[model samples]
Target: MIALERPDDPEAFFEHAAALLAEGIAPEHVSWSGGESADLFAAATRAPRAKWRGEKLFAAALLHRAENRFSLVYRALWRAARAKGWLGNPADPDLCALRKLEGEVRRDSHKMRALVRFREIRDAEGERFIAWYEPSHFTLRANADFFAHRFANMRWSIVTPDLSAHYDGEVRFAPGGSRRDVPAEDARDEDWRTYYAAIFNPARLNLAAMQSHLPKKFWRNLPEARVIPTLARAAQNRAEAMIAAPPTAPRFSRASAPQTEAAATDLADLRAQLACCEKCPLHREATQVVCGAGPLNAQLMIVAEQPGDHEDLAGSPLIGPAGKIFDEALRRTGCDREKIYVTNAVKHFKFTLKGKRRIHAKPGAGEIDACSSWLHREIEIVRPKVIVAMGATALRGLTGQILAVRESRGKMFDLAEDRRLLTTTHPAYLLRLQDEQEKRLAWRAFLSDLAQAHAMAQA
Candidate 1:
């Protein structure tokens, strides 16, 4: 094997790799070392250079914390030289490895930037800031410019175990040192630590989540980490105390007081009242009021758009071709249609007479607003744990917001009385799609949204 030695960084690795590639040396024949072994290719030395794009890729991939990262990068470079757009092909093993490394390095660099805390130190040059951090990757040199740009007005120094960066006006690097090199205590550290401790809510304590972000490896450098154990030990007691205290009055308790009695009254009487409703002009042309059907104590409530031609004649909701798609989706999600409450945003069909047939028409904002009263009353009666709002009109009816189906599909929003509203495309919308592939994809997505609602309802 052709043994080679270079600096322990991406730039150095790329430079050496580029030189070796120019020399027509294959990756399989090469045995690389990052300052650990003597160079056997001393006689094969040449000027090291790479393309701009290649250099950029190396810069990002170098930040990875993998042990054999250099070898993987070299393999990727070897393939890249032979084929154009090699990196774009994710099926390539080398390219995939490089991309994975890039992601890890990017996260590592972000954490280093967020977690670093500066301490004030006095020297011959007056006041200066110093911070010590330990990163998972060799990202100190790559991230040094961030500190220089952020603290351009102040003189600062950041020391890591593998590297050190100092910035007065310009950034410069020096050899890495030990934790003893940094001051253990600072005057302002206690004040910030006390402030953080005071604001920490014990009731919201999630130890696993907290540890995932601010890991145990980084705890030694953080001032707030000193009290983590004490706070964690007392979290249960503090949370119990908070729960034992009397509940505070809601913000709109008085404003919503009068409606509570009305909400508790009979729902059948409410449906009877809706039969003669003329709040909107849609009630005039429709055959009859299509009230919601299903179990009274259903955990899942599916709200669809306005009634179609078949549904309008049948005096029911979700009974046409679109209903077939919905039933299939419900079956795929293991949800029983008989056990779930089904309703429409508008009780009337709102369709245009096309020759002898009635063609479906979209409900107007005024119609949806007028119909919300009945929808809200159904919610108060059924009291579903999860409400699935299919299509834009259904969402507008429930939430008073006309967001696009693509924007809010499969996302849950909090409604009044602890009910969650999940937005998704209507089964009717699926039937209207022209492309077979797109229709199939949309059908799958619709089923996925139904599954989410099913899971939420069960929970």
Candidate 2:
């Protein structure tokens, strides 16, 4: 049997595996030599090497924090390299095991972040902070960067059984440390416990949920845990007291905008107020409210559904991928983009997170309705001769009714104040077309609608 050497280091492990594969070594021919899983100063990575880093599943599997991670990863990688349905089958046992390992590793990292409590200390140089924790896995080095970024100005050290990390402007990982190496408590710990008790709502207390999040194993080290038993014993009386207590004014209320509030004097004034508008929950998640751009006196107004990811960050409308297509089409039709007022029905971007990327999710009817007031005020100010609504969401935001853009495209309808409204497929729809002929036909139809709108504005 060919026993593995230097199995702790990722690069060395991959190199060994690569050489064995090149020698046509079979899986059963190899035997596992499971030693301590990290090499300290020499090389301490428990992840896949450079060549296999691109395979997300394999790389994540290598971070399992289990003693058998190396052997399990090699078996999984071997099956994958041999095309043994490891990559294709979602229910593959190896893949399923890797997913569970990755999830537990991630959970351990999150708990370490939440539970680490730093206390002030004095050294030969100056004041610094030190904290000690007994983490489930080797996460002290992995999470050192998070502490460095969060408390960049202050020096700190986090000690665990597996390793210890010190940050004096830069991060350095050292050998493991014991709880005696750090201070047990600081003067400010009492203040934190008081604040924790103040925020603990007895009415919302769920013991199972609380225990799940703050496990009994961690309670000994946590200062706030001292008050938990006392609080639980008195929870019933506290809840009753809360119910009998007289009602007080709210901490905040958006709907309570005073009736005596001053009205906006002009477009600029209205826009400045929109920037601070928290009338709906959408504003809380978005970067900022994006108001319309272009000449207020312009005869043509182009309205899209809402600001996309690009527009949200840039704090402007008609600047993303869809905007590029719309701008090119308008220029082709002999219409200057700057001459036309550009905006969205909803001023905030609505999206869901996909890794680091934000994927656009369609806004709901209520969200559109919440922002309808802003759209109506914009229309009142611009008083455009022709208004173009790009999609169903845009049409609904404008008129407060679900109108079919497919049925209404290219047909003009009279709006209030003798204004003309037209509907068309959103520029984003063109990018989703799979068939060449269908894309060409749709592009032609889109150009025709824009040309017709420009013609109506000119007339």
Candidate 3:
């Protein structure tokens, strides 16, 4: 058996060694080293010896014999190198340390990808910047272009134990060095904290998700880390407050119309009337006024803001892509589609035609107000046990205010006569997000709200 170590041309040496191995030469019979040229000899002569560039003979030795008795091999190699005067003096410990550090760095590269947290920063010159970091490896220099292209207009830097790399807004991969502390002017701690606080939705608090994306190891360095615990506590408090708060006052004064004694009979008649009625300007633009549809005595009623273009054309509520997503959500939540009525707050399809496409236009407050009478009529007739508001516009028409959808979603509120109302995200919002992970998260929140509503209805 032969063991050969060539520091340079390791690949060619390995190929030759393999051919020799095929010719029945044993690996234990060979041993050689040639300073910086040792790798080349090893590459040409050794049978599958690990090859490393530059003066990484120590690391290569470790890597080559790692599966075997690597520690013993390393010690033997060290002793041999010292006896032969190949080893440097003790004054330059960096040479040995760097080699070992490089090996450790190679082993832990994957962890850096999982732990780095990037925060957007801005300089006094109004230049955008981002700061990120990893524990030890110089992976940032190798991968800086990925982030620079992602945020091309931003000046950013990644700090690591070995080095720091910076991007100057246009070009990437400018070298930088580690600093003991970030400059006061460059530190965007407060701004990052504020932005994180403002954007985080308390209603959709998921500790696991948060921790997965921004690991706890990085929390100490993040400005938003200070608020995480507080934010979580506040979210819990807000949830409890929602459960304790009294129902909002009814938006419109109840008219003195004759109270129908039988809900079942009134609901039947109202359903019939909705199929034929020409109430607002919507009926003029659309073919027919579409009404809510489900079991006559459904426990839950889902209310969207208005009919979409497809829904308007089809003369039915919730028959488009958003509706399909809503249906899937209902199935996942175990909500009985047969027992859940679906309708819109406004029965119109408002749009602006762009070329061949009809872009959806948000319904105005006045339009919503005009349509509220019909929504009120539906509520009176259906007399559902619970209502699910699926968007801001739907919530506005139902609750009669511009409420914070992010804050209010998933909580049950009292409608008139002890009926419950649950607010949640619109499917359209989920559709607009380009990121698959964020979309999945939003979808989960949407499902959670629906599940809560379903559970409440069952209760």
Candidate 4:
């Protein structure tokens, strides 16, 4: 080992040592020992060495031995040098190398934290212990104290390139190669395979996001890596199958069993009963009771806010101006109206008379509450696979006021069982906008929402 004494300035020491290092002389082959005069001696000798002013020192000797050849000695001297702050400055290349080693140690510790899969293993003495790790660098001796404190009671060993650390109910670091004969008590590879398969969610698979988080390097060690390609292919196939599959048939919830059964039993009875319902006084001024119309087994259920003036007299759904817009939107979406059940949240018509004209009045909360029972019954009996909630009133009737209608309009929420509720603005709302530009924007939004709902239903 070479020794040289240099001045306090780190640059002088680095310059002297760098020149020597650049020469054929190895760091260990030179030595310098001096004080304030040490800088001049270092410049003269150009030796990498320990700077000393009597017992005090500013820098330690540098060695040019390979990592595998002198790892143990290098590590011991490195620790002593660090404790004495002999490196003068943090930016010194030798000091920088030491810091890089420190960083690598910390990175190894984190990797052990993330990837070590402890499996119970018994030694030749029949002592039980857990063992699972694969560290790529020489960090065992560098960070032995950490693992010693972490796994004190268990018998464990972490094998790395330079050394193997063992804790036999106590912590110990030994310099040697690892033995491959030790038997692992648990089959880690198989268990990981099972765990990997069970946790993969097919419903919410995002390939790009998944690949970003789990890069290919880590995948080589994971058992699930083998199945990733297959799983992705299966997901694509399933999505295509969904597109080809017919729309889901309506399903009645168990809660609506009695009402649904009644609705299914006699349509005439339900219509006759609703015609006399004075749940709200809207029926008195309205032309007639407009009931839901469509095939009983329809897969899609369209719930509008209320019956329009034309619909009230016609006693059918989608017969007014807004209804005309709805029909056009549906035609554009390629939806078959015959396959959908159309209904209203409010069964009774609420209107105010202005001369001979009757203007549509929004149903109050009370009317909505009173009429929800019939809608719930209709939902139960029809068991439509998907429910399209048009307008705030219809959405409020179905899902309550927990979520804002505008923010939640385009998303699908699982209501009960496999049933999904898709919310959108009513065509009437689009019609009411006086600004042509605003009307066009609103119509576009409405159409986009409907298109999304149609896709979701199909999915």
Best by TM-score: 2
Question: In each prediction, how many residue pairs overlap at the backbone (N, C-alpha, C within less than 3 A)?
Answer: 0, 0, 26, 10
Task: After superposing candidate 2 on the true structure, give the runs of residues whose Cα lies further than 4 Å from its correct spot.
Answer: 1-12, 33-56, 243-459
User: 448, model 3: CA deviation in Å?
Assistant: 0.5
C-alpha lDDT score of every prediction, in listed order = 0.80, 0.78, 0.65, 0.65
The residue pairs in collision within model 2 are none
True lDDT of residue 57, candidate 1: 55
Q: Candidate 4, overall lDDT?
A: 0.65
Q: TM per model? A: 0.51, 0.54, 0.44, 0.43
Q: Model 1, residue 199: what's the lDDT? A: 92
> What stretches of model 4 exceed 4 Å from their correct place?
1-266
Cα deviation of 414 in candidate 2 (Å)?
40
Instruction: Assess candidate 3 and give its TM-score to the true structure.
Output: 0.44
Worst 10 residues of 2 by lDDT: 249-258
Q: Model 4 Cα displacement at 176 (Å)?
A: 96
- What TM-score should be assigned to candidate 1? 0.51
lDDT sort, best first: 1, 2, 3, 4
Q: How good is model 4 by TM-score?
A: 0.43
TM-score of decoy 2: 0.54
lDDT of 3 by residue, 1-459 (tens): 234332222344444444543454433444434222233444444244433223424433332212232223334344434467545544444345545544664544555554445554557866544454645333554455666677676666666644566767544443444434343233567777798888877778899998875568777666678888988989977777767887564343346322323323465576565555455565566656667778767778889988888898897888898889988988898887888888898877887789977778898887777677667777776778888999889998887788878877888777766688889988889889999999999999999998988887777
Tens-place lDDT digits, model 2, residues 1-459? 323343224555566566655556566655544344333333332322234333434544454557666666777767777886657888988678877877777788899899888889999989989988987765565677898999999989888876788999999977878989988889978987998899988888889999887789888778888898888888889999988986331121223222213456668987998988877788988999999998988999999999999999999997899989998898889999889999898889899999999999899998888887777778778879998999988888776678777778888877754688888999999988999999999999999999999999999
Which stretches of candidate 3 lie above 4 Å from their native place?
Answer: 1-268, 271-280
